[model samples]
Target: MNAKMRNDAYSIFSEAIAAVDPAACIYRSVSKKDNELIISGEKYDLSRYDNIYAIAFGKAAISMSKAIEDVLGDSLSSGLAVTKYGFGNCLSKMQVFESNHPVPDDSSVKAGQMVHDFLEKTQASDLVIFLISGGGSALLTYPRKGITISDIARITDSLMRAGATIDELNTARKHLCSIKGGGLAKMAFPSESVSLILSDVVGDPLDVIASGPTVPDTSSFGDFNEIIERYEIGVTMGIGGLLEDGLEGVIEETPKAGDYIFEKTSHYLVGNNSLALQEAEIRASKLGYNTMVMSSSIVGEAREVAKVLAAITREERHGVSPLPLPACILAGGETTVTMKGNGSGGRCQEAALSFGIETSGLHNVLLLAAGTDGNDGTTDYAGAFADGETLERGKSIQLDAHAYLSDNNSYAYFKETGDLVKTGPTGTNVMDIYIILVDMF
Candidate 1:
């Protein structure tokens, strides 16, 4: 391994993650002044409210709640947070629940009930400070009257394996759950609420991130049906029946673009992939590398994205764009992986494997693709690293990179090559980071 170059890649990525630190993001957007609660310049009078409550969920749940609690202090009457298991923490005043991610489990139902109870008893004079981040869609959930967690899990897991986009999945989720698609915001009706969000979805679409717990949802039953048909998803948790009733005017549509339910509800994006990429750009420049922060809105299949990135690196190395030597190219966003084989890798690892294959002879360039949350898909590592010699090393070990990529088993390939990037449980979640370091040497 080229320790210096690899360390540089990790350095830039780390700086990016720090810039979107959940705690810092919360502190930047929220503050307490005299007798007022200020959020992103909007103030809600504390005098009118009997108590201020804070609740957050996602990978960033713990750090975010800590910042909120610090700002509110003793004035923070109560709070709660839900995060993926092994990421929970002990807060001074708020309760924390750890749940499953990417798929809702029974504990997710319990966490949903906890939030339900919190919102159910809220009075008109009370205020809710909500902290929403990536992964919340599964970390916090309450099924509709008859939908069980297993039902929700089956639908979600199937869609994910089928490569359904986050928006498509959230659209289906809205119809089946009572708490998604603005349902949480509705529950906080009559009480003023503000949500601080750390976006992980591509394009930062408000309604898609964490299924838009606080924002008004524009997707309807019709939209849900469209996604099901589009993705060819079967067994939609009886969402067809709900959409049928909705189309027949029996079930009320989800809160629309301009609903009174959102009158006092405010949503602010505290952190996003773009913000993280910008920070990475700054760090790379300081390290004597000519940095180009590519689009943070990158979206596509993992291997295809890898092919494009590798092509760009090839172009730069060959003077196509005439980029300066020692170039650091970075892109950020979430990518999808369709499970074609019983694979053992996530999207980032797959991308890394593809990159290694594409850059086999381009000696002197290195690439690292990793999830900011420190967990990639269902794997134990954040992501993986690759370079020109990766394929050669694999062949030396009697491993085949192309076969692994075909099987969606990139994790095993990188493991054998000792190239998996493991940063366990980073407390923040923005999106995935892809960095390519090109050196003339």
Candidate 2:
């Protein structure tokens, strides 16, 4: 491995994450000016509202809540924040709830109930501040009537294993949950609310971020059904019954663009993957590499994406690419993994391993792919690194990169080669970052 390039990769990744830090994102958009509250250039006259309450969910919940507390101070009534397990922190003005992620458990149900109950206490004159970020779809789950949390979990797991996109997964989740798909906005009806969102979804679609609890949902039951059919995911009996009810119009659809419930609701995107990628480009350029942001909406299967990136690395190395040697290529967005093997690995790790195999024996090229949330799938590591030497390092220990990749065991492969990038609980999520560096010796 090229030690300097490896270090620079981590530095660039860290800078990207810092750009989307939950608290900083909030502070940039929210502020107090005497009897008025300003958010994203819009002013809210504090005297007109009876109370100002806050509700936050997703991986950035606690940090975002704290920033709100600082901005509102004693004027802030009370607040609730629900985050993934181990992402919670003590706050002076708000209660924090910890729950499961990538899958919702019983605790998620409880948290959803808590949020619902909290909204019930609000009056028409009150102002609700919603702090939303990635992971809220799973962290703030409330199964619809007749559907169990286990059913939701099972479907979530199934769709994920089948490599469903975030949009597809959240579409299915929104239909099953009472608190998602503008359901929270519906529940807070009559109360004016503003959502400060840190978008982890590509293109910052308000309706898709954390399932868009405060925004109008463009997806419909028909869309959810299509996702299920496309993925061949089998629904539980209860879910199947609910789907039937939805299709038959026995149940209410999610709030739409013209719904009155959205009249007083406003949403502002405070941070996103593009913002992070911009910062990464700056950092990489400062580090003396000719940096270029390849894309900020990268998607598709992990290994397939890795193949394309590996090809770019080769092009850069041979002086045939758009960017010359000593070039850094950056791309930010989420990717999926179709889990055919039972082995453990996340999208980033899987991509890194595949890139390693394709670039084996090639010198002066390195890649790092990691989640900004400091986690990748169920592993402790955020992601991993791959360099020209990655495969050879594995061979020295009798490890075959191809075999591990076949088994979907990138975690083990990277762990053996000491290439895992671990940064525990980064307190933010704007999806994943990929850094490719090609240097001319």
Q: Write the per-residue lDDT of candidate 1 for residues 73-187, one digit (tens) a residue.
A: 8888998999999999899999999999989999999999999998999988888988898889898889886677888899899889989878888987887777789999999
- Local distance difference test values of all predictions, in order: 0.89, 0.93
Best by lDDT: 2
> Which candidate has the top score in TM-score?
2
In candidate 2, how many Å is residue 99 off? Answer: 0.5
Q: What's the distance in Å from true for residue 83, model 1? A: 0.8
User: Model 2, which residues run further than 4 Å from truth?
Assistant: none
Displacement of residue 51 (Cα, Å) in model 2 is 0.6
Candidate 2 residue pairs in clash (backbone atoms < 3 Å): none
Q: Following a full C-alpha superposition, what root-mean-square deviation does model 2 have from the true structure? A: 0.8
Question: How many pairs collide in each candidate, listed in order?
Answer: 0, 0
> Please, what is the TM-score per model?
0.97, 0.99
Which lDDT value does model 1 have at 421? Answer: 92
